[model samples]
Target: MKLRLWPDALFGRLALILVIGMFGGQLLTSTIWFETHDHRTLEIPSRIFASRLADTLRLMQDAPDDAARRELAAQLGDDHYTLRWIDGPGVAKAPSVAQRTVENLLGDVLARRLHRQAPLHLMDAELIDDSGRHRGIFSLFDSRMPSGDFHVQVQTPGGAWLDVTGQEGQAGRQSEPRALVIEYLLRIYAIRFVAALLFALVAVRIAVQPLRRLAVAAEALGKNVYRPSLELSGPREVRVAAQSFNAMQQQLIRSIEERTRLLASISHDLRSPLTRLRLRTEMLSDAASRERLSADLDEMDAMVHTTLDFVQGVEITEPRHQIDIDSMLGGLCDDLAETGAKVALEGHAGAPVSGYPRNLKRCLQNLLDNAIRHGGSASVRVQDERESVSIIISDEGPGIEGKDMLERVFEPYFRAQPGKTHGSGLGLTIAKSIAMAHGGTLVLRNRPARGLDAVLSLPRG
Candidate 1:
């Protein structure tokens, strides 16, 4: 599998971007500081040590003899440096890079004090050998201990050699290596880094809260037309988007209400005319023509009534609740059995789904009616999935006999097999509308073995 640096969710993507940006910026600033300021600060310790070395040289030159010089050196010695009198010019071993740099700095300072300079070399001199014997020594070499001595042979004008030695014993914490400085910086600020990351997480969450709430409200709106509109909050952009969405929702609700009211008025007004037409048909003397006219009038009246019912169903305003779909299907089958219909139920829903009880029941009722009407017997099956629930209702009669007629079956007033079934052709249409209103889908397919199957799939939450 390929590695994915980016996530699919908005929250994860935004958080990842924020963390990378913050961490990168911190790293860049620290690198710049270490280069420009941190390394340059190492010169301070070198300058202080150079000044003390020059003082030791000048004081030892005024000593009267070897014993007096040794006494004076002892008096001037400190924890960092131990002054002593020795008889050597310099050490035989070559100086390392670090040792050479220290030697150059001290030689330059001493030459400035003496007012003349050719080349000055400092060497090791064992004067005060009271080296710190740290117990539990772990190093392999005993000669390579922490003990160090600086021996300087200054040629006196009287042709005698003045061996001045200084032993630097104690280690100063200030003169640390570059890597050690970086390590200290990291250890000291590790907690601060964690705290800053936590702060970024919280800030990102607060910034993205509006989008999260908007998504939840949009999903709710898809499931329920009567869901309350979202309140405006958060950033300006998010607030504007929420306002636009709410406006669109209000316009849709208004349009649907207007259409429903108009259709209801038309249905009500035409009822009296349809009744008068039925009464007028009775006055006809021809018996065969009267029966035909009355039948047509009755069919028209039923169509109008079914149309009104469909319109009312579209305006459903039921609240969502946990519904046990299996129990509902069993109850519906029982009711149909009482009505002497061969309607049976199979399978079960393992859990309850959140939905509008009345609207969902009505949708199921229409599907079951279709199954029983088109086919002789109806079998309803409820399937529970991980993310969704399904209801498969099938019948034993012949399936849709005509091609291109399956989708047309859901069109209002467009019956595919006219005169074969007593229906207004609005049953499937209303059922599908209700299913969509509850964030579900209804599909119709012909079963090759027997008849038609209606599948209703609803989301799990």
Candidate 2:
């Protein structure tokens, strides 16, 4: 099995890239926020707690005796801060990792304010609710659960330990770790992911629309050279491409027109001289010489006519429309039957094809004629499909003598049976050209049962 981390389409791939990039940015931002927020949460409370402890210690040191110090400590205690005197060390159990961190920060602050060091031990330091239940300090950051408690014992100069407790609260209702985590996921990850996805889709779609239109225009050009020019209504690059394509189409049209005019001139100039030559041959004294000369002139005339017809078929500018292929094939078979040609038609085209009707008919007629002349009989079959349609014409006589001749037979003036001089040898050449003009293909192959098959495949769209 293979894993595909990337998508194939432009829109999908672009959207994936955008979403991943946004998520990475959000993660970095959250990490920075956590660091700064944690420091602020610890700093402000530590400073206030240290200042009050310094004042209490100084006042206790000035008292007359132990009883007086005890009475003074009890009077100075309040709701947010409390103090108690013990005869021995107050904290016995070891502090946790989080408690140790809090202990060191407060210890340093208190020593600086009092201008002296005292032996200090942290008893407890953790997040808590109003009911005084301990909460994990390593849980997700939430503004709701802002209250916390800090307890520590510090040894005074008189050899007695002073137990100190400080409680702090922020302005919000308390919440649990599970609820905080869910809130953080929804706010930070889910919202950003959905926003990035929508943005990427809209931006990528707008960017790729021009490219899609350009591709469709290029395809239409192949089927019809005279297709309407592309509309220049996109970004600068897209407009430039459309302009270039239109210029190329115009150049092609001009070149074809020039070639057609030249062929027309040549046809006129050559026929008059050939007619004069035929008249001169008819004036010959010997019947054998006259017959031979006339036959040669006739062959020359046939060659000229066939050559012009082939070129005209290729350069035809017929407009495209829906063609009933089955009806056309049936009609051709009936006409050939009346002329004593052994032609058979089978199968129907399930749908109409979009193409030049006259050119397609000419292409099919040429294939049928070639098959009947060489194979003595022709069988036509139509295979309709979703994307394309196929017309297969099979003949039943000795097929092409060699495999190489199958392709060579479509070349102009190249005959498969070299000894036979009946054909002008441009039939298959014209048929192939017509197929290409409609963005279709015409292929010839030899049959296993001693015949030839010409398959013409035309695209549905």
Candidate 3:
């Protein structure tokens, strides 16, 4: 058989979509975050360092000489200081505290040269002394030209005020911003990946629950098992699916009932003609021919009755009432024994089962009669299965032939043993019908050492 590739329930498809959506959302979010924030990650740190380094260079502009500039540079390049200028045109020296290892050798050497310069000197100068503290200032200017003249203000140590300015060294170099930005983006996406996986699993479970229930109900229905109609709940689509299942079940039951009613009506209508024929056969004059006609009519009558009984079995309308199968079977065995048939009860008894007592009794009676008629002695055994009940009736007689063992007995008017004038072969058929009517089954099998065994199984309430 060819199998369809799509899922058959709303929840299953929902779960698939949820998983796909979660994964897609995670991917999209990470992609956008990487695209937008990649450059910002490295630029933030670089901008902070650049601003502080610019302030330190301005401070060094008013220093008295190279030694004072060196002291200031050492102070600015301390472990706690994040600002350090690179070498440019005039002076050159390694920065004292190198927190970040610069990948470009030229940028590091340039920064060292700029730090050694005695600030950028210019011709315009202003002398300002604030208390006894020495202060220095320089104009903010573009770094492309090192000869630009700028104003300067300063206060010397030992309460002296002085101002001197001049043009200084060459402009500094910049490192590539790509690597740090990429690393930061990768870290962000890794965190989102773990979160997305957990969210996807939860989404899958919630979405698939309805589909699981539908699967269980469908399986039971396929097996001809009785299960309650599903509740119409969950998402709108899932509720619609449940409604469709309910409608389909109703249609199936309706079709079965209609077919059974039609068969029953046919059986009932045929009975009148069958009775007349039986009466008419009795009126024949030739004895042997009359007897043969009577037998044929009897068989026809039995067939009609069996057909009606089977049809009734198809309609399961009766509410299940608890019935003591053990007591019922025991009483039936005693009744048969009293009637001079060899029958007995054999096995441990269990609790009562939920079923139609009349149907149960009828099933036992049919089996016992068949056993006694063909197999001589019959024994009824009752036992309990976990959630159900079972009754086995074995008889001691010549066992059925292996070739005819499986399908012979259940068919109407099919008697395996010949030359025995008895009722039409409707006994096992009736028994099977009664068993089915009560939500159970009847099966016939040959006993290993002796005769035939009839097994009846009933579901528990």
Candidate 4:
């Protein structure tokens, strides 16, 4: 398996970026601080050693003879350093490369303290452990029990040599390098990492909240174009987006209103000519020709009305409210049964659904009318579910002849039984539109046994 170092979510990615940045910054800062601290640790001890050696040399120069000088050296001696009169130089040859560097550092400090350069020889300068064995100079600051041993010889005014042995004590051993590192990791890195993570999560959450709200509003717009506009409260970008969406909705509403008026005008104009034609047909003397023309006129009028209804169903202007599915279905069935049409309803809708009640009823009424007209009977089965509700209206007639006709029936002016004289062929088209307006679906399928089943499914929310 391959490793996935990057996260998918915006919050996760932001948090990871912040945490890594903080860790890198802390590492860089700690590195610089450790370097500076190490240099100071070495410099402070060197200065102290130099000052003490300078004072000792001054005392030895004032001594009367060898015995007095030896007595004075013993008096100046302490746990940190020991001084003695030597017959020859303490270090026979010159100091090595590492020792030379340290000797020069000490010599410069001693000269400044004494106000003149002193003839000095460095024999050994090294870090040591408790066993008195030498350790590498690089481990001086990091070592747990760090100590220093120094051997030096200085020439007096009389050309005699004085040997000094100095030792660094274990006063600062409690603050070990390992303990310092652990403290730095906890106090600096760990604390900051957690703080960065929380900050990133909260910041990203707040920033993305507006986007989530906008998405929800866009989805709802399809169901109801006149739903309340989004509240403009957030960053500038979010506010701008909300304003644009509201403008778009207003534009859609205006366009739909214009189309409705245009259709209404055309219907009115067509009806006036149709009315005149019907009046002129009434004056015809031949009875057979009059009846045929009257029937044609009636069909044309019905087609005009059905076409208008189809267009109106495409965009329902009514506001949504709670609808009792059971009550509505029962009423439609009762009305049809009263007219001697076979209609039956089975199953109950446990809860009311939110939708345009008139449009929903019209959709159901059209499906029932089609079933009764073609199949001689209609049976509706309501299936209520968690997210949506399904109303299955079945008929006992011979189902659509061809598989293609099942879908083609939903198209405007496309009738399954083309020779039928009653319908304007826009009933199924209008019903499908109403179903879509309520964020639902209307589909027709052939029953396993016989007849066609029209299933209308509407979302609960």
Candidate 5:
């Protein structure tokens, strides 16, 4: 069940690969951006806030008196910034890990701009809800401000602590600012990500569309080799494959036409000489010589006729039709039974097949003849398979001795049993051709129990 759920088609697997690759690429890009850009989110805002504190201290130091400094500090307090003065050292305890990091960053910025570093403490801002309750440990941010906020306190050389409070800019208070960074990342790149996903889907579909067309064209070729050429599209490799397949199909058609033309020409040319030779043999005075010559001429004529018939029948351009294979096999069995041959038909097919009925029959007749000639008796069974139909013809006589001759027997004029008296060794060859012409196969095997088995498997159209 697990294996079955896995993709079996090219489109499915390719789509899977494309999806994984594209998503993985997006995630990898996001990770790199996160690692490289994280510090900028906190560093710029913190330094600017720290610089503001340094500027405020300088403003206070330049003031005419402590009372005027207090007034200036009060004036600095507004919506976005709050400033206050504290007596002696403030936050007289150990600072937090986050506080240390912010202090170092702010200390460096202050030293560069002010020409000296001041004692500074940075810590979390008091968490506020919409209801204005102090939720110290909890944050309002889930997907937005997960890192939260902070407040800073810098002590001046005058022994007074200057309180500076503000956010870390739009980036937020938390040093990491994970949620805000993620949201920012999404806001910036979401459309591009979606567009990339769509582009990949369409591109993959376009790529696979050509292969599907090629597959359809191939199946059509099997049905009729003379089918129209495939239209070229898709990637370079796919287009090349389509072009090659179409060219091969054209070559096959030309080859078949040339072979048929050659056979016809040979048949027409051979008939005239054979006719003249028949006349010459009839004129011979010696009865025994005349009979022998006549016999030789008859054999030659029969061989030529059989070869022509085999070619013509196998290559017949008949339109395919649905036919009951069982009835056809039954009829052949009846005809052979009339001649006292021990032939029997068993089993049946679920569906009729589309084929050249006459050619299909001729192919069956050849197998039956081979079985009777070599095995003395034949048992035929028609089996229905998922994708094709099998017509198995087994014989009871001696099976072929040469294991290597199984496929060779289907080659023209190549005899399986060379000493056999009844054939021109073209029966299996013709059978194989007829089967192939209908997009089928004819394979001969030595039966395990005894004798030989000739199995003809034809695709169901």
Candidate 6:
């Protein structure tokens, strides 16, 4: 089987809209909150501390000679910052183990707090001591810090400015906003998913209310035509549809009632004239003429009666009942045989089916009468399949001709063999109508050996 995928329906679409809107609003609000809170909370404290450390570096750089520079580097070892002095050649020399240990400790603390490792970029101011030729080597990545990296600014010896800033690791650069962003997004999605499901359930329930009403009203209409017309009310568009449907139903009922009344009136007016004609024929003088006129009158009466029966038959709305197929067919065959008509029953049966017993009986009787009238006899069979029951009636008469097999069978007034006036040509029509009323179908097919097969298949209720 091929599967087809279509766009979301009203309920699903509504759910998506609700989830997206809610998630977007929540995400935007979270972003704004984080920006304001993070800047005021952590960044301010780190910047203040950096400024103080820079001030200490400036005092050390103001010392007069290499001796003072070395002493300063030793004194400030781990108290607040590390100090280093530069020679005239600006060469940087290593710091003591104490300074290195303090830096490592600070880096560890930052890593624990921020979930990332970053080096503190506190610069050491450089200056030559009183020995004249370059003092000792002072080490720092840069004295004039640029904004591209995380750095701080501080005053040095001789009123010069030095920039001290942090050195960022790859993980530090990526982790800050990336972790927060993923947190916010996952939260938004969780809320959105839950909201969407709730929205879908509510939307579907509301949307199907009108359909439920329509189904109930339709079922009631089928049971009783005199029931009140359905009222129209719902959403604007749905209301309009409901009104239109109610109007159409009323119109259809009116039209059917009118047609049925006309048929009844015509049958009444027609029978009176037919009765009068029969009386008039009784007064004819010649015996042969009177008999001929009586025969003609009888045919005319039969035609009128058959036509009226067909019209009224069309209006039958019988309630279905459980019927024993085996017994019904068996009884029918027995009746026909008692009447001296050659008929036989065949095939497996004994299936109970739901249908209009009276109407079904009339249909079968018509088919059997047609068979006995045209053919020498008729044979009846019944079989029950998984989905439905099938009844086959076969007649050994000269089977229907080509094209006539399909055409002549169902027409309202058309007859076979031109002028052989026998039936009102309504038997097959009535049978077909009865079958349709029971949600079944009747079909005509030529028997391969010789004859015609009438198959009636009724769906299982």
Q: Estimate each model's TM-score.
A: 0.62, 0.66, 0.57, 0.65, 0.62, 0.57
As for candidate 1, its clashing pairs are: 82-167
Number of the top-ranking candidate, with lDDT as the measure: 4
After superposing candidate 1 on the true structure, give the runs of residues whose Cα lies further than 4 Å from its correct spot: 1-9, 32-37, 52-198, 231-251, 274-303, 324-327, 348-352, 384-389, 400-419, 445-448, 458-460
- TM-score computed on alpha carbons, candidate 2: 0.66
Predicted candidate 2 versus true structure: per-residue lDDT over 1-461, tens digit per residue = 78778988776787888888888888888865554444445555555666677788878778888888888888998997888877666535776544566778878887887778878877876665445566444433434555557787887657788888987664343446566577668877788788888888888889878878988888877766777788997899989998998899889888877877777778788899999999999899999999999999998888777767877887657777999998899999999999999887878888999989988999999999988988888999999898889999999867887778888988999997776646888889989988987889999888887888999999887
What TM-score would you give candidate 1 relative to the actual structure?
0.62
Locate the minimum summed-lDDT window of 10 residues in model 4. 35-44
Give per-residue CA lDDT, model 4, range 351-405, as digits (tens): 9998999889889999998898878999999998988899999999888877789
Writing each residue's lDDT as its tens digit, candidate 6 over 237-269 gives 778777876887788778877877887788788
Task: State the lDDT at 364 in candidate 6.
Answer: 92
The whole-model lDDT of each prediction reads: 0.71, 0.79, 0.59, 0.81, 0.75, 0.63
Candidate 5, pairs of clashing residues: 149-173
Model 5 over residues 316-367: C-alpha lDDT tens digits? 6667889788889999999999999999888898888878898899899999
* Residue 434 lDDT, candidate 2, scale 0-100: 85
Off by over 4 Å in 2: 1-198, 274-304, 401-405
What lDDT is obtained when candidate 1 is compared to the true structure?
Answer: 0.71
Model 6 quality (TM-score) = 0.57
> Local error of candidate 5 at 183, Å?
10
* Candidates 4 and 5 compared by TM-score, better number: 4
Best by TM-score: 2
lDDT accuracy of residue 195 in candidate 2: 87
Which structure is stronger by lDDT: 2 or 4? 4
Root-mean-square deviation of every model: 10.5, 8.8, 14.1, 8.3, 10.0, 12.7
Model 3, 223-266: lDDT tens per residue? Answer: 33334678898888889999999788777778877887788788
How many clashing pairs per prediction, in order?
1, 0, 15, 0, 1, 7
Q: In model 6, what is the error at residue 6, expressed in angstroms?
A: 4.2
